[model samples]
Target chain A: MSQTRDELCWMTISEAAPLIKRRELSPVELTQAHLDRADAVDDRVKAFVTRIDDKAMAAARAAESEIASGHYRGPLHGIPVSLKDFYDTAGVRTTAMSKIFADRVPDEDCTVAASLKGAGTVLLGKVSMSEFGLRGHPTSLFSIPNNPWNLNRSCGQSSSGSAASLAAGVSMGSFGSDSGGSLRNPAHSVGIVGLKPTFGRVSRYGVIPCSHSMDTTGPMARSVADIAALLQATAGHDPHDPYSSKEPVPDYSANLNDGIKGLRIGVPRDYFFNKDGGADPETLDLAEQAIDVLEGLGAQVKEVTIPSVADVRASQGVIMISEAFAYHRQFLRDRHDEYGPVKFRFMLGALYTAEDYLQAQLLRSRICREVAEVFEQVDIIATPSMPRPASVQGDMGHPFSSLGGLNFLVVFNATGHPAISVPCGFTGEGMPVGLQLAARPFQEAALLTAANAYQQSTDWHTKHPVL
Target chain B: MAEHPLPSHDELDARLKGAGIQLSNEELEFFRGAYPEFLDQLKLLYSYDVTGEAYPFDVALFQEPQ
Candidate 1:
């Protein structure tokens, strides 16, 4: 590996970990390289909200000393990473990019933050998110981060800064929340790999709540291997979160090169590829090409359907807003003026009847059952992460304008399944398109295995935005 | 089924206030513009007419990992 600073900033964690572990590369040097690159390029992306430059350097130096003493913690030891602003870091301000919580700081780290720190990763500080992770709000309190690939286009939210930072090479890994496509949408928009692990696989102990039932925390990185390494560090049960699953954690990075031979990959054409629900022709073509790549890897492919996709989309919206309102009702009542335009989103929840909320939950249950039936037949399901490329600012039409719009990504949130968006191909405009794969609950290993196999066969994940 | 009449602006406003939310005229206008689509989605969810016991939990909630 070359020793250039620019190259060091972009090296995936999988590549940097072994060298850092063997004492061939200095953790301080690697962290400093990324911090310098972030200083140079983050102005264009506005990816970070509070960069703890001194703290990051201090932690990197400590990691270096530990490794030099032959105490390498793991793959993440000395690795630089960013947290989406929603995750609480003790003694650090953890605003969700909203003025409402602008002065808020926590006394404890979130479970995932603690897990990463315990794994010896260096924190690069908090990144921006949509106002309280609600979409359709004016980003008045924070800078609207630009897509590294095309600054003029919107880096889809609410994990906008997380994906933007990774694509810009400001951070090697990032963790973002996804209630309704927050992680995967931006990953699709920015051409990175985003994983939304099974709902309970990772704890949300201290992260700001968006939709309790739907919200999940997961990793976004440049490749499947990097995502696996990051997940290996942060995933597992924490007793603090009531919703956290007790499932045993597995080593996500151990089977990356196992290949997808004899695996079953399902493609649901009615909802994901049809003219009514699929993305534009070019985007769909790219997704189809990704499927072909999977087929070329000796995987058996077939068509399948998870029923009531439209109903799931509608129910997810209702439940998400209602749950969010449940959390923010007091703030909206007292400090309405302090909120960004997202107050409109929170207020809409007030209109839903208690029955409406229950009905949405019932529909969610039905959708989960439907998806489970599909998973019984297919090991993994693949679809276009988004029906279109990155939409320009102020031009995001209604969510219904395209097939793969937010609907395709939100279904998994409703079903509580694990899903990931891997860069499949780029449009003629050079915008990235993502092929999303989802598996049964706790089947993230299968999902990652298939995605890693596909990524191994394609070069799309290697293409970075020329920032 | 009987027609589920949509709420009037006054009714919506009262409901919001009942929930401890009062919007200014501008914010009221923003809510007015955004709430209809949300209402339509609620209607879509009700369109399915799901019956029997409705467990309002995610798939992982009740079941242990396999």
Candidate 2:
């Protein structure tokens, strides 16, 4: 049976790979189907800053020829994927969704982008992102991408376009940067899977930096298996990225279905559930129910605490803004007026005393130590991805609003642990809430294994928003 | 630092200007209005009691090289 363009567009990379290898689905045909769907829905979703229609088509044709010749790269070989605008693409304008770099086109690709291209994935285009992943428009200035579930609400930040595109079936998979919650935040809001591998798991060679210390490049897709596939293709040591880990990359796809049986799951109940005003009551309930699902699956669930929970947010804020300011000091000095109000607030990094910045780092080191000890007692840790689902579009409250948005997710970034967000359930209003699972540093295999098992037991990841 | 001390607007504006960054009259005014709330959040770091600890520099702080 021939699948319709709609069906073809929504097929996960895991589902499409075998079909392409078997010659039952032509890469060109699949790519054309996604391109057609993107053309139809992107006007409403506004998920792309630049659409590389011709280039994507050409690459699809090349992939189809290679497969037809009995050569297949892998799961991502012919997948139609996109990147956040901040990742520099050779010969493509890498604006980071800001006017400052509007005319700038890079001559080289970021290592992650280049690696995906090397794997024979079709480059659909550059998706929108918050300017430099912080300080600029809440949504892209190109257009605010609307959440597929509720057009009036946000999809989520930094990776807004990537999530919106995946949710609306405009793209099958994509990559996003996270120093804070940029990757999982959007994944949570859009009801998809996003994995922030250990900080050095993926290279940051050409991806723009918001915080050098915490910046992590990660994969976002509709399924845990798909995220595993993407991570498998991208994770490794890179000579160009000094911070890239020398740790041997593990095969994430092989162990995905291994299930979470016999694993120790730490709930972080008191600390995470009540820290910083906690998540909305229903969001907390959904998280608890998700833990119960794991318990039913033979996983041992226990309450654990990582000291200085509140301090994670505060320290992350200071270090991130300080590093971001260091990166953007020249721009802030020369083109102050070009930045949005959000940027003005963040660029106030200039106002932080050097002592404050250093003190925050010291606190980060202490918190990291405390969290490592907690991990020694549990195989994995789980928490809600956010306090609530997507807020109303452009409703970013006051400029000085509490940085509580990062309360649930930033600790992992601080500790450089591998974390993944899987859809746990929906709010009464039908927006999605995410259950975040973090494993020990560089243990993404265990993290993805747990997430994939939880996804298998629940239908949350399979539920899509009707546009 | 006090648990939640307010930053002076005049002092903040002077600091931003002193750093060689120019803000429009409107931008300066907005920063003046928002400085207090921002400081309130920043002050949360001071309450952490992070004495004698070194800054976290590398991911090896948690894991051994494999």
Candidate 3:
């Protein structure tokens, strides 16, 4: 079968791996097919900031030779993948979409990138992202990756290129980091699966820091099974990352068929579902329908209230801004002229008093305690990923105004929970809507299991945005 | 805890200067508008009563010696 018609672009890593293992297809040919598609669509979509086609093709050839010699790696063997610009790659520019680091190149791969490479995945190149992953419309003067579905619409932020590249078929799977809603927002906007594993599930060593408190690296792919496979390869303890969890990493792909039977799902009524100006009616309807579907799967669904979310969101912003400012202080002082306006101004605002930073930390403690209590009552919580789909393109006058009131996903980041964004449905305009599911701290396995169950029961994750 | 209004553009610029950072007039004006809302959202943290608790916002990784 022809590579394009083989559904390889949309197949789960689990499905694709078996075919390659049996020698039914060669990794070099598969890599070439994806590269061809990327070349045809990337100019219009602007999904990739850098393309290492020669290196990728060389790696693909090596994989084919290795397999022919009866040496097989795991599921990710020979799979072509891309990393967000923030991930450090030796001898490659790891610009975080900011001119501040425009000429900066790291001498080693990030822990996560090293792990992916160890799994025998082909490195495509660096994908685009926001300037320092800062707050602003993605279309700032810095690199703004366009949404593959609608060129003018926002592809979310931070992990902007990961989503666009995946949707545009630039790579099979890609790396995404979430300090706030970077991963989830782009996943929702582009109709892909984005997982923000438990805060400590993946190592953050060598990833450009946005917020040490909330930063997490995870996978974005076309299916939950693929995410599971990617996480299996990436999740582990790295001594270099002080915040890396020492907990035992479970086999995420081993029992993905385990259904969501007898699981307790909580819906935050007042905070998550309140008639806030945040979510549109259509998005809310899809969230409610997702609850019904979970109920039908023998899961108990109930409405719960999380009163401390307002405080949590507030504390998160303060701490993130304060830390981000501290990290970029020297850069802002020496290379101020080179930074894009959005990132430069945003960091400048972080020059508040140390008292402000401490006060935010104190508030953060209280909010974390409150969230821990809420988790005691339920196994997981569900909410709409975004209040609405991606805003119309070129509507970037006031970036935050364009965001409306959609702060649901950011709160989870503040609480340090494991969250995943899966496609729920599409809007009348054919834009994708996402259902955000979160589990308590260090419960990534449970979260992935539930997400896998949902994906198995529905076809949402299998649908890709047609470029 | 009365609502803490954001500092004026001049105040913000002065604070930036105190920290050894400089901003252009256009950049200052751009931040002068956006910082207010950003500060307002961040001020919500002060509304909580967290007296002596350690903030639980730091990342915790399970590490083993390589």
Q: State candidate 3's DockQ.
A: 0.46
- Candidate number of the best DockQ: 1
| Candidate 2 positional error at A226, Å | 0.7
lDDT by residue for model 2 (A1-467), tens: 39998999888888999998898988888889988988888888888999899999999999999988978998888889989998999988888877778888999999999999989999999898777786224532566688899998888887888998899998889999889888999999989999999988899999888899999999999999999889988999898987788788888888888887899999888766874575688888898899899999989998998878766877888888889988888888898666665667566788888788887888898888888888889999989888888888888676656454446888988878889999999999999989999988889999988998899999988887787
Q: Which regions in candidate 1 have their CA more than 4 angstroms from the true location?
A: A276-278, A397-406, B1-5, B56-62
Worst 10 residues of 1 chain A by lDDT: A397-406
Model 1: per-residue lDDT, tens digit, A209-258?
99998889999999898888888887787888888888888878777788
lDDT of candidate 3 over A201-250, digit per residue (tens): 89999999988888889999988888988999999789999878777878
Ranked candidates (lDDT, high to low): 1, 2, 3
TM-score of each: 0.96, 0.96, 0.94
For every model shown, the clashing-pair count is 2, 1, 9
Candidate 1: residue A77 lDDT (0-100): 96
Superposed by TM-score, candidate 1 places the C-alpha of residue A375 at a distance from the truth, in angstroms, of 1.0
DockQ per model, Cα: 0.57, 0.52, 0.46
lDDT of each: 0.85, 0.84, 0.78
